[model samples]
Target: MSLRRWGAVLAGAALVAGAAVTPALAADPVAPKVTVAPATGLDPAGTKIVVKGTGFDPAANDGKGFGLRVGPAKADVRDRAGKDFQVSRLIKKGAVGSQIPLDDNGNWEYSVTVKAEYVASGTTYSAKKQPFSVFVFGWDTPVLTWDSTTPLKFTEAGDAATGLAWGLRHSWRNYVTRGGGTVTPSNGATLDTAAPNVEPYPYKWKYESSGEGTVSYTGQVTYTFEAHTIWDFTIADPRITFGGDGAGTLTAKVGYAFYGTKTAPEKVRTPSDVVLADLKLKAPAQAGDNVAVDIESAKLTAAGAAAFADFYKPGEALDTGRLVFPGKSGPAPTSSTVPTSSAPPTTTTSSSAPCVLTPDSVKQGNLLWGFKQSFRRYVGIGSGTSITASDGVEITDIDKIDGTGPPSGAYLWGFDSVQYKSATEFTTQFRGKVTFAYPAHSFELSIGRPKVVVAQGKGKLFADVELKTTSGAPSPPISQPGVELASLDLAAAKTTEGAGALSVAGIKVTLGNAEAFAKFYKVGEVLDEATVSLGASCAHLPGPGASGPGAGPGVSDDLVPDVKYRPDSALASTGADSGMWLLWGLVLVGAGLALVLVVRRRPAPGQRP
Candidate 1:
């Protein structure tokens, strides 16, 4: 339907080699036809169609009754009047147009008025998509296009007055007032991509493979100025890309202060990702999927004229442009004010896909537990007790049902990494760091990396905590990092596939958070009992991990390879293999294989992960 459809590649609408129209007179050779009924949504005082032509010939053009407008889509209009209408009317033969009476077997119904500028006041659009045809002209016979069938959309307006306007480089806006500096734009993300960009901001997209030859624009623009401190430079966020014929690219985040040599030793240099300006789309204007660009002069590709010192050369004509694109992913601007690596957009994959279990469907795994027993005996009772357990954490008694019966302080944590979400859902990560010192009650606690995320049955128990309290209790010691500690249940469990291993136990653990991870513990209480157990493909799911105490160089879950454990055992070592994304997340937890998970929040620690 006509809500949007572009691909002309370069402005000229006709596209796809003139929609269709052959056999000038083969009788019913698809006889002259045209239909537009409720094309689609069209609101704002628009929508009243009925074009119903069938086998025309009431003297053909000698009849001068055709050319109904709303262009693009199966293209090919062979224009003649209505100044190439972007919305017109001309069913001529009496009032010069609009005289639908016909019935000499030429049959005609023709009502009309599908305008409102063909709708599109705001729905962030312009990655090129203005296609929407409905014609029945015959400039010398050969016309009939109504967009296949019922597909003329447009009824969801409400936010498009401030849609990006950009004036970013006319020599950097005439050198920002002769280099005194000032071009700030914030929160409404990139503040409209800077430079007196003026009332402009309403764009957002998700079609990167979202369809068509590449489309990405999250937007951010900055270009500070200065004189001979060597032009104190500062090129803020900018990473816009458009590739489909007229080609384009711009990457930013440069920093500068330069002066003393030794290869310009640090005075400031640290903003990375150059490759600034190199676009070339002289005159674009699609509207609704966005794209208002006008690269009137842009050049400077050698990584953007090597950040300026040589004064422009890589292709010479640097910037006289204006871009408007479909940027601004919605009234979205609250993630504590969007600082997402300044503007990182380019990810689209999800069409049901996700069921994986691969990595040899997890050979061996381990996560056993015992996080509480009177708080591990009041932090090992004073005397400045110290209970450290590096990377592959350990200080176990292997569940003698801990309750403080005999050194059963419990705390296994190993499974390097696993978040297989779906194929029965998952979230099993564990690296270990237990440390519980007692500098004589100044109080300290640690819980390094631990995730448990089951699915259907139930699960939850994130980690990465480190508290240290003293001064006046009631909430002091906190070093936070994904805390959500405990809430699992995994009811009536069942999973016993073994050539060597794969068991499932009576899962149930409470305590959602008490001063964020057991201070005195009591929020539905009940803590003690957890077990995962894996072997090979699971451990090397990635590599080079465990970087706190004792660090890297590990892989001992009882010499991995074709897992198989019980009554407990696999003592220590779960460090290496942690970045082939556990081998593409176990090839997307294989099982009819699919991806793009659900329960968000897990990419940010260096995010984009």
Candidate 2:
């Protein structure tokens, strides 16, 4: 073979060998393994991030001295927005190496590419590049919603128009803000007539009349008003009705809001202070035209106030007052001087309906201690004339109807009203005269400082005994006197004869810290942003050591997780009436009567008697 041919064969073999071994030669240098610590997660935006790992260049100085690159030969490391990566921390590297600081959001591909070359003799070689990837999540704000079911109504007897007008007028004060104005009702606005709307907040409702044919009639009919919010919260259910034909019955439910945050359920505080006022009720048909029905009784109560207050401020207390009804036997004499054996059985017969004891009969073994009486007439005119009396009185031994105890010490004010020495104190007393048609004995009593109690049957009607202070002066209304009882001060100018009425079942008042009322409820605690923000600045301290590329991994970067909490509005309802299962004894009675008739007409089995 020729020498030239031999050389060509050898060269060709060498080229083939080099091609086969290319991958091995280019393979990464098997230097000491440098495992980068995982990248700690990032927050919403504009924040610093750290990357911890072992085997970083130890000699690199701070910020400018050493930094991080996302990936390979990519000349400049830039964020998608074209911003250069910023190095914020640096630490001395050791067995447990330093981290690379970054400022960007999204997937990041990194490689430790050094600009300086490690020179040996006349040759120079750059540090081998290592690549890795990390993910950054975008921040999102949370949203929340709320909702509830509620029933509402209003009741006043005698005149339907009068009751309707009074109800429509007073419903506006359902939700009061810092100002005296209602949050939903707006300034000087009336409820929407078509579909009653308080506005802004989302409340919708309707009203109806209990015609003669209806078996169960709320006295004098009723105008139901419903209120709700866009968040699906029910502000109120106005079933507050008066029983007429015989006994009056009414029911109600209300929904409201509480403090809340972006991610928390709505926290409901106390119900926007509720009240009934300006009850100008016309007299019954029998009363001469233009003769207005005077307030027979006026009452204020706080039985449920504590329950509502606790819902607003968990440990907060509420202010409240009691209800008063005049001519209603004062506290049903617990101790009697009259002998039971010699006393005549008080026959209580009424032309309208049978005298049924209010609050149902109390059960004591097989014996219930309760009695029913009719509003009897005083036959003597001025203690001498025989006049028929229509204003009868029914007395019950239920202590639940008595006046409330002393005002709560925790209230904004400790009293319901102020005593007056003269009508001059308030512009005037008995500004409006109250008259009754049937039991016509009209002698003016000092209407000042009267112990007022409204009857449960009258819609917003209140009754009080005209008691002159020892100084022979008139009493001031809660507003002028600063009593603010019943939270009715706002509507004082709109005062009328009767407001909304409710069935009297003898409310049981349990007084205590408002928190006791929340015992039945399981609600989540809510914190204002101000409270949480303060925690962020809870004295930051310098970590034990520095951190970042070229620095050693140490305890400094171990930060506790941040927390965001809010109150839970989705808690289950635990109020007394929230889950009340009312047993309509009247309805049952009607059903029983029908069954008795059915059986009476039934033919004897096979023998058609």
Candidate 3:
């Protein structure tokens, strides 16, 4: 549908009698071409939907162009109001904000308001209520040869109401008014004062229950009709209720009078609290007890029809109107949460102090890896990638790692979860997550809880890996639990033993799974090597990384722990080459031992005297 919005209406657009021409029936597929958008989800918000037409009869209807209208579904050429006097619109030049003049080619573009006025049909309520449609026909003579129809869908999806107004039934009210009868709202039923007086349900009433869905109103109206004493009837005190789930009822008091049928006296009866209509709520409000809405699709009940002397049949359409309800308020979810207490935990010393070092003992050290350099470059820290580490994990000394990884950076993840099965076999697991996020591409890779297992003289590195990427891109999202990421070649690895300590350094790292990269890298790729340094006090043994009574030379520590010597803390921070650091620490150790011996030998001053 070509539904383009038109801004300004043609100025001084006038409707005049046109030159006459004999009309001929338009044939099939020979109708005027027209288009409109959104044949559904319509409302009365004054929003205009533009309609454009071509090939309409310019010579028909005395050259005044065909009439444009919106009435019912199918927009039948034979019926203008489409079987019900409910709602329709006739397009007249500058008439009630609907106007568009046709050019000589029988083509024109116009805008029509979404709202439609219900035209009273007869003594009955509307026969057709839903699926309103749009149509085009002759203004005077009906030449329906050229035709196009579009069904409109209306919705009040998110609408709410607190107060309501309804005229009960459109045709009944019109019939009563034509017969000089009266309809009054006396008990709390008020008028809008500004709304059109012909509105069916003009009496406004306040909602009594705002229980979200189930609601009631606080007013009533009376319909009084007495036509020449024929059959005087009064339906009064009408009430409406919504059950929230599209089912409800309407109750009212009724009074009927059968003025003597030529032989019998007048028969008068009053029935109180009669079920007037069985309401079928149309498009009820969404869930929650915040606001009430319209009670739609109301129909006459059997008792109601009987009370009306069968003039109207049971299960017929009744007027359903909106009720403007106020929003309800209450305590929010967060405010009702329980509070937590604050305290500290107590720590107890292990009874097995000065213990022997074992392979099962927990150790402390760090591991380094660069991940992948190309992918890191694609999603740098600020551009598209953000990396975070958490869970008792501290990653520092980022630049120390060598080889392909993050640009100008690699990482060291310090782990305290270290255990050993034997002196030569040990396993160490990391504590935290390093998440690389690429928001622009909707891709993320998180590698966490890395565990390195060394057996005999060989080892492997594994970690929990979660990868998310578009399937349209390099790879699909996946969660690989305990993925073997790299193989550790410990052949050149150096394990140093100290006072109850063990340090394994310089283990080569080779890619074990290219899939861990989300297909960004391939297999057989070399990554940064790693080191493990740990120390713990044991039963009858000094912990690792300890210099016991000047007994040995230094160890490797470009701060990495190396075989033969363990460097002092001060020398470890120098960033010296690993081999050089090991050699220097040994020199310092020898010097320290000489000093200790000299001091011990010179301490016999009392014996010399």
Best by TM-score: 3
lDDT of 1 by residue, 505-570 (tens): 445667787767434544666665465554333122211111111111121111111112122222
For residues 1-609, could you state the per-residue lDDT of candidate 3 as single tens digits?
Answer: 211211111111222234343334344443578877545544333223557787765665565345555544433334432333222333332121112456666677754334433432233222135545666666545665655676655545333334555556767866877788777766556643322223232555655543323334555556555564535465555555545445667777777666565235376666567888887655434313233345556788998888777878998887665544444322211112111212111111000112235654444455555454323433453343566656533333233223323332444454557777764788887666778776545567788878889898888889889987643333567798899988888887666665555556556777788766654444656555566655442211111222231122111111111122212332222221211101000112533311111011222332210
Per lDDT, the best of the predicted structures is 3
Error of 3 at 413 (Å): 3.0
Global lDDT of each model?
A: 0.45, 0.20, 0.50
lDDT of 2 by residue, 1-609 (tens): 756566667777879878532221233322212223222211111111223333222332221112233222323222211111122122222100122232221112222211222222233322233221221111111111111111111111121121111122122233432223333431122332221111112222222322321111011211112222212232343332223321221223334443353235364533332432111112222111111122222222242333233323322221111111111122211122111122111111001111111122110000001110000111111232221111111111111111222110100000122222211121101111111122112122211121212232211111232311211112221112212112011111111110110111111112111121112111222101110000011111111121111221121222110111111222111122322211111112533311111011223443211
Deviation of model 3 at 369, angstroms:
3.7
lDDT of 2 at 136: 18
TM-scores, each model vs. reference: 0.21, 0.17, 0.30
The list of candidate 2 runs beyond 4 A from truth reads 1-163, 166-182, 185-206, 211-237, 240-250, 260-307, 310-609
Better model by TM-score: candidate 2 vs candidate 3? 3
Note each model's CA RMSD in angstroms. 30.6, 42.6, 33.6
TM-score of 3: 0.30
TM-score of 1: 0.21
Query: Which regions of candidate 3 deviate over 4 angstroms?
Result: 1-356, 360-365, 372-378, 400-408, 414-418, 537-609
